[model samples]
Target chain A: MTPQRPTMNDVARTAGVSLKTVSRVVNGETTVAPDLVAKVRAAVESLDYHPHLGASMLRRNDRRTRTIGVLLDDVSHPFSAALHRAVEDQARARGIHVLTGSLDQDPVREQALATAFAERQTDGLILAPTGGDLGHLEAHTGMPVVFVDRIPAGVTGDSVVSTNVSGAAGAVRHLVAQGHRRIGYLGGRRLLSTARERHRGYLRALGSHPGPAVHDLHDPTAAERAAIAMLRAPDPPTALFTTQSMVTTGAVRALRRLGRERSVALIGFDDFPLADLLDPPVTVVAQDPSRMGRTAATALFERIDGYDGPPREIRIPTTLIPRGSGEL
Target chain B: MTPQRPTMNDVARTAGVSLKTVSRVVNGETTVAPDLVAKVRAAVESLDYHPHLGASMLRRNDRRTRTIGVLLDDVSHPFSAALHRAVEDQARARGIHVLTGSLDQDPVREQALATAFAERQTDGLILAPTGGDLGHLEAHTGMPVVFVDRIPAGVTGDSVVSTNVSGAAGAVRHLVAQGHRRIGYLGGRRLLSTARERHRGYLRALGSHPGPAVHDLHDPTAAERAAIAMLRAPDPPTALFTTQSMVTTGAVRALRRLGRERSVALIGFDDFPLADLLDPPVTVVAQDPSRMGRTAATALFERIDGYDGPPREIRIPTTLIPRGSGEL
Candidate 1:
């Protein structure tokens, strides 16, 4: 038996109209009469003829596909993933879809992903740019773009980021109050805005402290390697402040490897999974990725809705959770 | 002076072609001659006329928007996020965009998200289904769909999952070897395939060994709550086997709260961040989410490329890493 297919003709017949009228209704052409359009739509629904989405979009003004693009540094990271989920949730409520990509912390990949999203004509873009170059966003004016998490050094657009500097300073103050003088900084790539701002806060907190600042640790791409390096150091800082989740993992791992897990105090910038489970639980400056994501999506939707307000920068606050690791 | 908006006419004029020919080229209609099409393309590139993607797609025969949809239980979970990134990476390489959504572990939400994606006419779909019902996938015919992580109870389709049963059995054997006769199984929602399989493995490993199996521990919906319930039990099992990361966190927290941090043995299913940093570093059955993601993506792309040999189920393996927590 041949399968039956529903077509525009069937819808038109059911609505007692010409096929062109059905086509107009399906494409959402505004020229149709209101009463006739409603009848056509009801017939279309009754026949279960889902208008070809691409065709329907074509006949509409503004030509939006009702989709947005989200690009992150690493989707596997807890913060990035949380933010991604938040954005998706908000987009769903607005009857929009989100296209996601991960740069794996590579700039070339980031550019490629952004271009692909734009070429597909995504209505807007949300990116956590890996600091390399962002000339592409400037060149492409077809879509609205927002930067999330880390802001690009050269390019500026709508951005939503955590208060990294203040959060780091707060963490340092908390450590200092606990009488930690020889505090060492564990950081990620300096190119990232969060890392730079966090490092600045570390320096600001240690400004006149009469201790030798061990700026020996530089960028360790992976957490495992960073942890090993810190543990092998001859005179590791008594108190360690890690700038990111990967760095936090590294610092904790290094302390454990050196059999000094309980001796050194540690506070990480990003809260990670099982932080409190560690022998001496970890203290961290926690940023709400979900809130950041919601704000970014809301901003993009507002732009799509023709809100011509000036591009705004939003900073979400961070909290300090004291677990056992920071008390050592 | 106001900037003159470039139009299709200008592009055709520059390329020395008629408006009809330019329209044909822009819409990817096959009637345009090859040589003229090349000239029109060059002119369009120089003019940077990104043909209204929606309109052009509407005119195309295949009706392919070159977009795929990915639905997961929770995108923020480390494993789910890793899988999402992998799928995105693979799709980007093929010049396809990914529309993503999260079900928040709700079956009703999953069904709604699936419908939303289908309404957009996504070329294919990747789903990590929330348990309950999945009649939607069957209803939406001709769309390629792949199930990841947890498979729906009754629905059958292409699936990629970790070797939960074998991995759990391995963990139990390891615990048995370590001289723990009374092993406790902490699991997530029993409806999940991973949870059920892992629990079965625990029972299989403890064949004929009599002990209390506290299957009453609810799903790790709230890790803190689950942790408290497990710890407060009058006679807690000597070794605790947590089947998911959230459960792992809860169990670890419970141990710490009860001041038995170093007294109880704990082995978790999913490897989490800073597991080794805990006082008695957690032992775990570690599954490589990235590898699983890569494999799943490759399988999906193969299916998308029209390799219809048969619907296949691929299983990735997991490994057990012994740490102080399990040794306890």
Candidate 2:
């Protein structure tokens, strides 16, 4: 039931001009006469003629569609959204367009999306890979791929990630300095590299005392349940180090529900919106997602522009903002 | 430098088979013999052959690209991101991918991006139109266009938006019921229809007792400045009604800075992440962006699937959550 679209020939006939003249005018060539240009424009307006970018790209000398694909964990999440926006900003400045898909931590979806993007002949791809074997991507030879937030497993590529270990360590150390020896750890899925790294840091900073730890608290509800259970235990943690923003939110909710927010100190791994506006303003080790996204995009663009150097492992630093929560 | 990619001919040559046989195997034809398919697969693996979707689409009977373009104000914002994710969820279920762009409220950018998507032959378009005139889009007569979060100004199209006026009125009425006769307004850009609708609602609920108001507080910093000035004035509003999430954040910041957070009553129009964890737990009139996004996508797909119908206007309802702040 698709409507018939007006072709260039139709525009040419309507304008009483040759097909070449219509094409030249539509392409914004300098040689077209002013009257001819006006006639072509009027015809185009009346006929609603839209040029086909795919056809034009097939004839382009450079063979670049000026489009990139971005595959992320979840586009709605604050961290992923920030990264996508940063990439968009850079791509826009360079007159490029972006096609994005959410992988949802599914390796099958990741492979499918990567293949789809490749078939579409995108110039490059930037991805936050799932926690699975990336051996399937080896077949996409010469397709410039840049990983963000996580390093690729079984694949050689440039990656931009946060200093998760140190950031988590710093948070735990800050709580310890507050004389909180019995600390609780709220974290994300164990399979994610970021979560594992942060957990390592927590253990390192906790020294010999391996306080209560919960794994796979991917969502706020799960984390909230875990937090409530831990807080009600006999020897509850004096402080908590939440390894992710969602987990941090769940812990905060649990504390509020228990009316113990002021008594139990907390330091979250990632900084989120309104962190400082809470009752006892949330303390957080904030990762620079914008910087990481910008860096990943820059790396991908470089690869597409013929930078054939060795793969890079770029780690962006994090900052700890101590608000009322950590001090308490 | 772009590397040379292996063509179908190369795969045939390597597999020692006819080009037609290799093509059949690559296209997943059932008539291909198992041995011949294995040979083609081996050759494809060795040569890293990738089928070009552009060339295949030229031969496709239906000529559908199975992709759509989404234009938003800014994808990084929480509301936009949530809406985008909802659209993505629907598109993925139908095996469609999304190409997105940020218009940044610039009419020029909006036109450019729309034209670009049209040139790319996207099956449909979902737009949050800028405040400027949308007459430029009238030329895309047969293109499936669905507006989200705002109605098209001068174009005939399907649209899904929130109940802005009623939601705002509900927030104001909730405050007035709590004996707040002097309520301040923090709003977004005056040019935006949503902001104007909310302002109208506020005025309607106030019933001629026009309290202090601020317009064009598009950002938190600007809203904070306005709120501080309003609060420092001789006649300060006892309560605040912020018409946007960012505006609400600014008002919250202003109250905390003045040490009047517990004393001042605040109700925001849009709910955001961590709103429930704030000191008094932010009271908000939450708009259903996800529902709006899903509805807009469904309508656009219907049009794309050849259901040519008259333009429709769909409004999703809003919810007023009475958290502690609004009851103050």
Candidate 3:
């Protein structure tokens, strides 16, 4: 038969110390005396006590796992990657570990990942929801959750996001200042809060500046297809604002295919790799994903530390970078 | 007292089935009869037999954990992130989950992360070692390990990396062809295997063609600091070769500060966001991080599946894209 696993009580008894001492040592609290620490360590080693991290965390009076789950649409995305690193850095200083999952922008996958993390009893969750109803999360888990980037409808949580509306409006304003009216909006899924807000910003910005024809082709599922169709229209817009990095790439590809790359001005939201290297360097409204990540992680950690004030929303600013494409 | 957790035997008994049938249902193996599967499901729910994932894994004859630990220097780096996502995608399809930790390029942290993951009994480890000694890893665990990016010295394991030497040489050749005789090299930590390889390539490419004044300022702790020092150098080279993306940013900042932004030529290894948007679009050798990640993950999964064959080193090719900077 396999050996029975030693518990915290065993370690405390072996060390001739109180249960609280063993808890303090296990938790890495520095208040314990050095001699007592050595005794506990010796006893732990002798007992061969391998603490069940999850169980110990759940039973602890403090109720901190010192672990957080980060669910992203795709971990490999440049934006997501930057944010993840920043969050990890911040979490590490507080002695926390990160459990990450890629949802692949699927609602079912998102739900599964969230449920798995919750089952593992992660202290908190930082998620980039796949724009689907996450009602089950609110109903099932009482864990503190902070939404990042795209926010799902009917789900209430603390959120850290870029100023999508203002950023999109700024891009349109820049295009208008360059004497271009008749602008087209290339976006991802309309269901995405970010995409919808950007589209709204485009309309509002266009209304402020007269003579711009605003067309919203909010089909992120097939951005390239939508971009090609928009460009092939009888009268194409002179300027285009592509929301999301993938949409930017598709719009650029469509422009290259039509051989009108330089004829139309373009500005993309969320910068991507090789954007600036294209024929006319692509301009973009760059969101600091790392900053956004740091903010979200900070908020989650604060909540974990007994800050039960209220749900807060933090928006990191985006910068409009002008290149040949945006300048036309 | 806490409720006693139910075991597989109890579940089978309650469901009026054999232990093997219960195991089949839990594993999602399709051999079980439909009626029996329903019965097992009902029993599982009724008894709240939350199958200990690790325990169920061990009970199986194969004893596969179906989980891997990914230890990268910084998971937020675009290259690292891309690779991580690919690995997770592949792992998820196989019912495997990835547990990730960032080492922040610290050897001590890397050791701590490795210990933590091993304690959790991860089936395999995918590491980007901090160029620190990996003797502890070899000594402690018998789990399958795959090294990504920088391979540590004296440690032999399956590794996946980009062709840094040839890629760097190709970049230098491109600059040399563009009439750049004087070139400066900005690199990261020289101890890193990739950094050393890239430096070697830089020397080999410059050796035959009008020996460029090479300044091997390897391993600038921060990009901004490196950028300032490189730009302020007396008799700075006419062209620059940045070995890493962070180094590339430093070079760009330095060039802009010196007002040589439009005049100097640059070719960086590893592309970054908005590389082209600067006054003159920067050229680079782009490595497909996603492919590297997928390949590494595939190799790890294969190893986990009892492929105890000889260890191998796999190198993915990098491509050079010429833009305004290289052309200059």
What candidate 2 keeps of the native contacts, as a fraction, is 0.82
- What TM-score does candidate 2 reach? 0.92
TM-score of 3: 0.78
Top DockQ prediction, candidate number: 2
True contacts kept of each: 0.85, 0.82, 0.48
The best candidate by TM-score is 2
lDDT of 3 by residue, B286-313 (tens): 9888888899999998898779789889
TM-score of chain B of each: 0.87, 0.91, 0.87
Q: Please rank every candidate by DockQ, starting with the best.
A: 2, 1, 3
TM-score ranking of the models: 2, 1, 3
Report the number of the highest-lDDT candidate: 2
Q: What is the lDDT of residue A229 in candidate 3?
A: 78
Cα lDDT of model 2 by residue, A183-209, tens digit: 999889888889899999999998888
Give the 10-residue window scoring lowest on summed lDDT in candidate 2 chain A: A134-143
Candidate 3 achieves a global lDDT of 0.80
Question: What DockQ does each candidate score versus the true complex, computed on alpha carbons?
Answer: 0.63, 0.74, 0.30
TM-score of chain A of each: 0.87, 0.90, 0.85
TM-score of each: 0.87, 0.92, 0.78
